[model samples]
Target: MKIFYPLIFSIFLFCYEISGQYYPSQEWERKSASSLNMSQPLLDSAINIASQNENAVNRDLRIAIIEAFSREPYFEILGETKERGGPAGLIIKDGYIVGEWGDIKHVDMTFSVAKSYLSTVAGLALDKKLIHNIDDKVYEYVWDGTFDGSHNKKITWDHLLTQSSDWSGQQFGLYDWADRSPREGEIDDWRARKLYEPGTHYKYNDVRVNVLAYSLLQVWRKPLPQVLKEKIMDPIGASTTWRWLGYHNSYVNVDGIKVQSVSGGGHFGGGIFINTLDHARFGLLFLRNGKWVEKQLISKDWVKSVQKSSKAKSDYGYLWWNNSQGSWEGVSKEVYYAAGFGGNYIIIDEANDLVIVSRWIDNSKIDDVVRLVQNSIK
Candidate 1:
C-alpha cells in the first residue's frame, strides 16, 4: 500500500507539472467589490483601515537602519538605496484586483521580500539539477573558501534557505558578526560569539544571506537578476522598472567574467526595488502554484516546499513567513507570506484564492486589515 501511494503521489505531481499555465494581463482585471461577492461597505472599510494607519518608521528609513547598527549613514557602508515609497497595496481575489490603495505604480526598495525571490532562484536551480538536493553540503558545489572550515563545511542548502546556517564568514565587505548583533553584548563577545551547530540556531543575518547569494552565483555562473528576469519575471509579465540589486562591492569573478551577486534584502543596501503591481503579479504566480501562461515558471513542488515551516522557526518558511500561530484573526493558518522590512508583505491565502500586497503599512494593524478583507467575502 505504501509503495502504491508513493507512485500515485508522483503521478499527481507529474500531472500538475504538465498542466497549462495561467498569466495575468499587463493591467490586472478589475471588478466591483460587490461583483466579486464582497460587501462594498466592508471592502471600503478594509481600504480605510490600510490608508489610516501608516508605518511608524516611514519618517526616515535611513535613520532606522542607522539606529539599528549604531553606525554612520548606510550610504557610506552599503552604497545607494532606491528611495523608499509611501504606503501602497493591492487586493487580488481569484486573479483580479478587487481593491487597491496608495501609489501602486511607485517603485521602492522592498527589503527582505527579495529573499523569497532568492528562494525561488534556488528552487529553479534545484529543478534544473544544478543542485542534487537541498540537504547536500554547500561546500561540494562552492569549493571556494566560503565553506572551508569545519563549522561552515557542515552547512547545507537547506540550512541557508531556512536562515539556520550559522555560517561564519564575511561577504561583500560585510562581516557576519556585525549584522543585527545583540544590543547587550560587548564588542569582543559579539565578534567572537560561539558558533551554534548549523541548523540549530536561526539568526536573521544579511551577511550570511549575501554569502548564500554569492554561492548561488558560483553555481549559476551568471548574474542572478538576469536569471530571475529570464526564468520568472519576463514570463509572468513583470515590469521592467522592478530591479533586483546587489551591493556595489558584491561583484565577483565567475569563469573569468565579473558577475554581480544580488543581496537578499535592503539591510545594508540594494535588494528588490519594485512597485505594488509587480509585487501582486509575483504573488499571484505563487498563488497559481508557479504556473504562468502555458509554462511552469517555478515547480509546484517548490511552492509547496516554501510554505513548510523550518525546524528552527515555526513562524518562518524558506524566506517566507508562515501563519502557523494564526495571529491574524479570521485568516487561515495555511496562509503564508513573503515579508520585508518596513511592513512590506505579499500575503498568500491559497484557500481563499487571495493575494494581498501591502506596502508601508503599520505592522501592528496588518492582521486587522487582513481580517477586514476576509470579512468582506460573502
Candidate 2:
C-alpha cells in the first residue's frame, strides 16, 4: 500500500506537469534571435554610462537601492516604482536590452503599468470598434443595473481613461476600504456615486481604471485576463508566467443588495507581474509604434492617442505617464513611460526608439534614478 501510494503521487505529479499546472524552473533562456538582437550596442553603451554615474555608487543612492529591494515605504513612490516591490526590469535602447537587473525569470508586479497595457488593449478594441471612441459612455456596455440614476449615466469611457470621473474620491478610498473588507459591498460603494461632473475635473483614481477594465470585459464578453492573453500577451510572446490581481468580489450598496462585480475590487490593487525580459519585449512593441517583429499588434493611431496627453491631464495620457521628469532639468521632453507604484517602469523614448525598464525595490529613490538615467542619456 505504501509503494502504491508513492506511485499514485508520482503519476499525479506527472499529470500536473503535462497539464501545465506547475511552476517552471527559473532557468533564464534568451527569448529568440530576433528579440535578442534588439539591444546590442545600445546596451553596451548604457552599461558603460551606468557604471560612471556617481549616484550608482553614492552612499545615499546605494542605501536607496537596497531599500528598494526591501520594499520599504520611506521613499516616495514615483514613476513605475510603487510602495510595493516590483519585478525585474529590462532596458532597451534602439530595440535591444542595454542592461538588465534583478531576476530575468521572476515575474514582478506592474501596478499601474497594467493600466498602460490595458490602454493598449483599449486601443485594439477601438480599432475593432468594440469600443467606439474615447467619448463613448461606459454605461453603454455596463448598462446592467450596476450603475443607474443621474451621475452614472454621465460617466464616459474618456472619463475613466482620463481619471476625470466624478467618483474619483470613492475610487481613491476604495483601496483602503478593500484592504479592510474583500466583500462585494466594499467594491460597489467605491464606485457608487458621482462627486462631480465627469470630465470636468481631474483626479487620479484607480477605481476609474477598474471601471475601464469592467467595460472592456463586457464588450468582449470575457474576463480581462483572457482578453489580454488572446489579444496582447500571446501575440507578443510575453512570458506566460504572469498574473493580474483584482477582478473578483461582490459589492454591497447603500441599499444593502449584493452587486455581482468583477472590476477593480481590491483596495491596494493588483498588477500584471512579468519578468524583465518580457517587459523589454513589451516595451519594444510600444517603441515601434505598437508593432511586434514587424507585425502591427495595435493600430499606430491608437498608440499615438494613448501616448498623447489627455485634455484632462497635461502629464497623463490614457494610462501612460507623459513625463515623469518633464520639467526636470536633465530629463528629455520626448520621454514617456508606463509607470507603476514601487518603481516598476518601462520608460520609452519614441523619438530615439529607446526603452528603459527598471524594477526596483519598493519606495526607492525614484527621482534620483530618473535623474541619473536622464543625465546618462544626456
- Using TM-score as the measure, the top candidate is 1
For residues 67-153, what per-residue lDDT tens digits would candidate 1 score against the true structure? 555552122347447457778899998778899999999998888899999999999999999999999999999997899999999
Q: What local lDDT does model 1 show for residue 140?
A: 98
Lowest summed lDDT window (length 10), candidate 1: 68-77
What local distance difference test score does each model get?
0.84, 0.57
For each candidate, give its TM-score against the true structure.
0.91, 0.67
Clashes of each: 1, 23
Clashing pairs in 1: 22-293
Off by over 4 Å in 1: 1-22, 71-76
Candidate 2 structure lDDT: 0.57
The candidate scoring highest on lDDT is: 1
